[model samples]
Target: MENTESRNTAFEDIGQRISKAAKASRRSVSDIELVAISKTRTADEIRPLLDRGHRVFGENRVQEAAGKWPELRQDYADVELHLVGQLQSNKAADAVELFDAIHSIDRLSLVKALAKAMDKLDRRIPCFVQVNIGEESQKGGCAIEDTASLISQAQAAGIKVAGLMCVPPSNVSPAPYFALLAKLAKGNGLKGLSMGMSGDFESAIMLGATHIRVGTALFGERSSAG
Candidate 1:
C-alpha cells in the first residue's frame, strides 16, 4: 500500500507534467483528462487517490469494476468510470449501466449491441472508437482502414462518439502512432484522443491526446490479475 503523502505527490507530479505538455502543444490543460487506470488495484489502494479528489478512473474488466465502483461511487459523487478494454457483446448492457464512458467501441456488432443497450436503458454514455493503429493481429481494436465506417455506424445508432483511442505497438517509438491516431481523429471531426499510458503520456499530450490512461505510475504497480 502507498502512503497518503506519496500518493498526493505522485498525483501532483503527473498533473504538472500534463500541464507542461499541454502548454507546449498550444492546448488548454483543462482540455485534457487524466484517467488513472485502477485495474487490478484494490479499493484500499485506490482510496488515497480518491481522497485527493481524483475521480476519473479506467478499468479493463467490467466485472472487476462492478465489484468495487458501485460502492465507491456511492461514497464519491464525482466518480467517472471508463471502460478501457475490449467489451464483449454479451456484456454491453452491464457496461452501459456501469461506465460513464466506453473507450473500446471497435466493431459493428459492439456498436449495435451498445446502441440497443443504451436505448433499452435510456442512458447515453459517450464512446471512443478504439483503432488498431499498430495493426497488430493479436490486439483488440478495429483495423485502421475500418475506423471511419465504425464511427459512422456508432453515430447512426445514437451513440455519442466522443473520439478515438488506441494502444500503439509496444517496444517501439509510439510517437508516430500517436500522431497518426490524432490525424485520424481530426480527419473524422472527432475531439477526444485517448492514446497515452504511463510510459508515453507526455508524447501523447503533445500529439493532442485529450485523455490519457495511466496505471502503473499512479498505482505503483498492479499486484495480480483481477
Candidate 2:
C-alpha cells in the first residue's frame, strides 16, 4: 500500500495530467469530472483520497459499495458515488439508494428496474447508457444500434440519462471508441462520456469525455485479495 504522502502525490499527478489534456483539447477542466475508481479498495485505502478532498468515486458492485460507503459517508457526508460496472436487474433498488449516478444501464430490463427503484425511493438517479463500443460478447453494454432507444426509454421512465459510458477493447488505440461514444452521445443529445481508465485517460479527455474513471493511477495496483 502507498503511504499518505505518496497517495496525495499520485492524485496531484493525475490532476495535472487531466489539466494538460483538457487544455490541449481546448476544453474547460472544470467541465470534466474525475471519478476515482474505488472498487476493490478498502476504507483505509480510500480515506487518504477522501481526506485529500476528492468527493466523487466509482465502484463496480452494489454489495461492495453498500458494505463500505455507508460508513464512509457518515464521515464524508458530501461524497458522491457512481456505479461503473455490470449491474444485475435484481440489484436495481439497492443501486438506486447507493449510487449518485449509474454508468452501466445496458438493457431494457435494467432500465425498467432502475426506474421502479428510483420511483420507490423518490430519487431520480442520473444514468449513463453504456454502449458496447468494441462489440465484444463478454463485455457489458448495449449494442450501438440500441443506444438511441435505450436512452429514450430511460428518459421516458423518469431516469436522468446523463450520457454514455464504454470500456474500449484493450491493447489497442482507444481514440476511435472514444470518438464513437462522443458521436453516440451527440446523436442522442447527451453530453457525459464515462470512458477512460488508468492507462488511457489522457486520450479519453482529449476526445470529449466528461467523466473519466481512473483506478490504478490514483490508488496504485490492487492486490489479488481485493
Q: Pick the candidate with the highest lDDT.
A: 2
Give all TM-scores, in the order shown: 0.97, 0.98
Give the runs in model 1 whose Cα sits over 4 Å from its true position: 224-226
- List runs of model 2 lying over 4 Å from the truth: none
**CA lDDT of each candidate?**
0.93, 0.94
Candidate 2's error at 63, in angstroms?
Answer: 0.4
Question: Number of the top candidate by TM-score?
Answer: 2
Whole-structure CA lDDT of model 2:
0.94
Model 2, TM vs. native: 0.98
What does candidate 2's lDDT look like per residue over 1-226, in tens digits?
4477888999999999999999999999999999999999999999999998999999999999999999999999999999999999999999999999999999999989999999899999889999999999999999999999999999999989999999999999999999999999999899899988999999999999999999999988888775
